[model samples]
Target: MSYAEINGLSLYFEGHGSGPGEPLVLLHGGFGAGETFAPVLPALAEQRRVVLVDLQGHGRTADIDRPLRPELMADDIAGLIKHLGLGRADVMGYSLGADVALRTAIQHPELVHRLVVVSTPARRDGWFPEVVAAMDRMSAEAAEPMKQAPVHELYAQLAPRPQDWPVLVGKIAELKKQDYDWTSEVATLTAPTMLVFADADAVRPAHAVEFYALLGGGEHDAGWDGSDRPAARLAILPGATHYDILHSPLLARMVVPFLDAPA
Candidate 1:
């Protein structure tokens, strides 16, 4: 376990597994921390060094005065990497974390060798209307009700001050209200990327194809000799959805090989 002073916040990270292979950084979704990947962490760490980081205001990392923004959170990740002396590492993030990974690759290209963006899209509108509506309903009022839910229970058990849950909820709701579009920036990213989503995820299937095409994928079929394949890949796992797909066993099967592949 370690805490690095990054971008004015004490970033919390824990290193899992030890080996001589490439390092992999795992970033979790909103309302979650590193332990959110608990189901797959050991399996992944078996293949490479997995660094789990809790984004600002989550897990052991205390919330700051500023609201959450992808660009700012991406900076925090880059600073932590430099602090840990991992010049370049494979980055994988789920949902909210995926947005941060995309921004990291966009703003600090040199810090990331490969990126795995799971359950995320290039634009805010890519999310289905139902998902957007649910997010819109998130507010301080729901914080009390959420305490009976697993995410809040996890926070209550782990947060520095469990009583701050309402404040966190209000801040997250405010952050989600902001609009963003990263399509042009995503096209310019130099690092290879993999887009992974569940067959029944919050994002529509068309948007996944759209995201991949921006990274030079899904435009055409590789020749029989395999000469025209794009560096990036896209996977939509069957029998999975936005909420539980992160822990699905298939997630490892789809993600690990890409991380292990040559650039």
Candidate 2:
């Protein structure tokens, strides 16, 4: 575990693999921290340096004493990357982490070489509000055993894994104290990027398509074209729901190659 102080917040992270290769930073979703990427990092480490960060209010990272928002969280990440001296690297984020990833790229483009966002929603629509509302309900009911669902079992229709339950529930609580708005930040992104989603995830596949269109359509489309345009790319994974896909191998299948591919 490593720690960095950025924007008055104590950020915690785990770094693995050793290489001269460009680094890959993994960011976890809401109700999750860096630990969510534990299962998949080993495979990725074979080819590149891998680092996972626990965002503020999650994991070992210290929660803020004041109100928090995604934009503020994004700034925290940008400061951390610069503080670490990693001028550019591949960055991948899931769910809420994807929101931070998007904002970080837009706010600090030179610091990010490639951007990969999983289960991310389009910023134009009211998708972020829908997501936050669901999170609100889940967090409020987290302590109720009768209402508490098995973290993995809850998303079994998408994938099967039983890791990091307590951490997820804690993160939900942390989110309740946050005040991020993801919709307004999308249009600002200008990094070479990819948006990966699951067909069954809470963030619908259609939003992924709309996100690609927002980046620009045709060969310039970030959705289908793996070409020169890097601001964004979109891939929809079948048989995945919001939370479960974080642990699923399918995410790695799309992400590993994308990260390893030449930029």
Which residue pairs collide in model 2, if any?
A: 192-230, 193-230, 222-233
In candidate 2 the C-alpha lDDT for residue 241 amounts to 79
Q: What TM-score would you give candidate 2 relative to the actual structure?
A: 0.77
What ranges in model 2 sit over 4 Å off?
Answer: 124-185, 217-231
Best by lDDT: 1
Task: Extract clashing residue pairs from model 1.
Answer: none
Residue 212 in model 1: lDDT: 92
- For residue 181, model 1's alpha carbon misses the true position, in angstroms, by 0.7
Per-residue alpha-carbon lDDT of candidate 2 for residues 66-176, written as tens digits (9 for 90 to 100):
444556787887887887788887788887788778777877788888888887665534255576676557653454462255434433322212233444455556655
Count clashing residue pairs per candidate.
0, 3
TM-score of each: 0.98, 0.77
All predictions: root-mean-square deviation over Cα?
Answer: 0.9, 5.9
RMSD of 2: 5.9
Per-model C-alpha lDDT, please? Answer: 0.90, 0.68
What would the per-residue lDDT of candidate 1 be over residues 108-182, giving only the tens digit for each residue?
999999999999989988999888888888788988888888899788877887888998889889888788899
